[model samples]
Target: MRDLTVAVFRPDDERLEDAVELIDSLGATAVPDPMLAVEPTGSPPRTDADCVVLTSKTGAELVADAGWEPGEATVCAIGPRTADALREVGYDVDTVPEEYTSSGLVATLEGAVDGARVEVARSDHGSPVLLDGLEAAGAYVHETVLYRLVRPAGSGDSTERAAAGTLDAACFTSSLTVEHWLEAADERGNRDEALEGLTEATVGVIGEPTRETAADAGIDVDLVASEATFDALACETVEAAAPTYHE
Candidate 1:
């Protein structure tokens, strides 16, 4: 099979190194073009809650930066990555759902949060599924917007390359990545072309929510990770593109 060019849109950090390793493992060229830039909005509130829910690594980083004490609170993360982030900051994660979506977390935390105080820390653009579900389950939910998602300045290049079908596949970890990429494509005056190009190259999403988000935005997703993790997404992308390269 021919070597493939896989565009990675993760942040420029250790996570990006992980993505590059995965791409190299698949014998693909890693395109290190970060699409979204995360900035902490402000210090998160220190709450004396019974449990704390972190949905993303960024949220975990924000909470750690705020020097909030977990105290006796049960720390629940959405997935292994978030759990690892929390653990890196001296908080032991109590629960990580089998599935890694907000709906999945709500399902896993159903009876556990009843009549408990739960704090949710995530991005400003996060969905309210977990918060609403916890509130419905009788938890006093305190929500905090830890970070905001912004498009980096040079992200337009990758969007244009994707639109022009110059890349073999594009891996998207979050719904906001897809949104921002398309928005940048539109701003570059090739929204339609970019959407068409997405159909030509493989589109690998991290999970179901991101797949749905891409579909809603009129992009057909070619691959979805069984687990909502970057490694799984990278594997799925390579598997989805293998047949094309061999043919």
Candidate 2:
């Protein structure tokens, strides 16, 4: 079995180190070229919501940065990573759905949030599933965009590698990563070639929603982790690319 190179397109945050460690554990070279930068939009408005929902680790960090304390309000996170982020900043999370998607969060809050007040903090580009569902379920939802995702400057190396067909697999944690990666390839005048190259390589995504998003953008996802976390995505990538696993 030849050593594989897995290109990781994510933010250069603590999670990036986790992905690198997981790839190294599988004896593969991890090429981490962060594609997106998370920028806090602004300080969130003062709210008296009964519950606070955080959908991403960046959102948790942003809320903490805004100096908002979840006093008596219930803190609900979308997944373990987000929950950990909130916990690390001194908030005890009250709920984390078995599934990590917005739909899953909505399902968990449906019966519990009737006639309640909820504040949701997430990215500006976040989907409306959770917000809309909560509102429909009788929660007065105060949705705030705490952060925004933008393509980082001078981070096109992984896209170039993909264009050159040098990567064995690429792990995309979000749909934006796929979009930004292809946009970078297009900027280099190699969009078509990069798309072809990606078709030959394994595409690992964090969850079904991201896989659907990638597929909508013409990327055929080869692996999808059962859980929506970097570690799970890295493991799925290894399983798809490891020669011993194939044998």
Candidate 3:
């Protein structure tokens, strides 16, 4: 069998081992080239708000890291996994979108936002779409940067092969993963050739935004999980790409 290389651009250390296990089960080499590295913010905010919006599991973990818990106010999550994470830490999630995205979550809000205060717990580098949309809905948005996502230092030789068109697929969990991969490709001077032939290979994305980012980068997404969790994404990638490998 030809050796298949699949890069998992996972930013979180907590999720890397599981991603590796799943990728290895597919008989493909998994590369740990993290495009985004997360580091926690100093502390959770002290101000009280009417609601808290969590955009990622990373955000929920940060809240736990800060030793804070949601009290009285409603907690809204962008997806089920995020809500589950919050629930693990004792938060009562009031809203979670069927589609795992900020736009979808914002659309599912309970009441008029006028006079309500909402705090968004997320990475400093994350998109401001949710906060802006919430404010536009008349909720006072308190933006808290609970973590920062930075690109990891080295991506190694397999990434070079991936850029050179030898790899079969790549996995993306966040829109930033696609952005950072493209940036890394640019830095390595492989941008043009990489995108042109990217569609020939499979791309696995976690959510709508990541899928859209893959499409914007001219890569065809061949797999997206029914659920937005890391495990679900990895399983979907293997299940979707297994037939091709066997054939």
Candidate 4:
């Protein structure tokens, strides 16, 4: 009965540290491998839109730090965290979808955005679902790339562990993290072995898009967390890997 070793791929920020701590508290050994790094693009969302959508907390913080204010525009955040970030920066969050995904925002704003200008501000890797959905719903949409998510250098240790079949489980928070993890594995010539090893491991993902990416990449996902939070993802994965973790 050894502690479950779960690999977590988050950006090298407080989020990564939080993931490690959460896994440790779950009685698991966390292999912290940062697969995503945020590089600010220095572009801010235009304030003239009828409605503004901020996707990630990082996007909200970046735009606010750059002094980009959403004036009179209905402020919409894709998730509660994004909403909190917006509110923390002296902005009003007028809308937050219940689902907290790109499609969720589309559904929440579709009726109101007809013939209105909608500005979507987020990372370059943001799913096209939100933009395409909004466009289909008849909103004149604009996108602002607040930052780019890049794979940090030397981030493939988890891939190596996976290739060796040492990792018991993994928690992936985004589609980009899943893609980056496989990319890192491919770079280390362990893509095939790593992929194979993952078949035996419990793979937990946060969102539908991430699950789709993992499925498309030929990875078997064992669970999709009931919620998109890291705590749910890590706890569910650790429990699946070691059922007695909480007991």
Best by TM-score: 4
Q: Give candidate 3's error at residue 29 in angstroms.
A: 3.7
- For model 4, the superposed segments whose C-alpha errors exceed 4 Å read 244-247
How far residue 52's Cα lies from its native spot in candidate 2, in Å, is 0.7
Models 1 onward score TM values of 0.94, 0.93, 0.84, 0.95
lDDT of 2 at 206: 83
Clashing pairs in 2: none
Choose the strongest candidate by lDDT. 4
Clash pairs, model 3 backbone: none
lDDT pick, better of 2 and 3: 2
Candidate 2 segments exceeding 4 Å error: 244-247
Clash totals, every prediction: 0, 0, 0, 0
Q: What is the lDDT of residue 7 in candidate 3?
A: 78
lDDT of all predictions: 0.85, 0.84, 0.76, 0.89
lDDT at position 198, candidate 4: 90
* Model 1 spans with C-alpha error above 4 angstroms: none
Distance from true location, Cα of 200 in model 4, Å: 1.3
On a 0 to 100 scale, what is the lDDT of residue 61 in model 3?
A: 75
Q: For model 2, what is the error of residue 71's alpha carbon versus the real structure, in angstroms, after optimal superposition?
A: 2.4
Q: Taking the tens digit of each residue's C-alpha lDDT, what string does model 2 give over 78-178?
A: 99989999899878999999998899999998999999999988888777888899999999999888888999887768767777877788899888888
For model 2, what is the error of residue 94's alpha carbon versus the real structure, in angstroms, after optimal superposition? 0.9
Model 3 alpha-carbon drift over 4 Å, by segment: 26-28, 110-112, 156-158, 223-226
Q: Compared with the true structure, what per-residue lDDT tens digits does model 3 show for residues 1-247?
A: 7666677887647677777878898777787777888777676854588888888878887788778767777888888878888888777889888767777777777355678988888888666678777888889888888888888776433347665777777788888888888888888887777775566567788888788877877778888777777777877776666668643
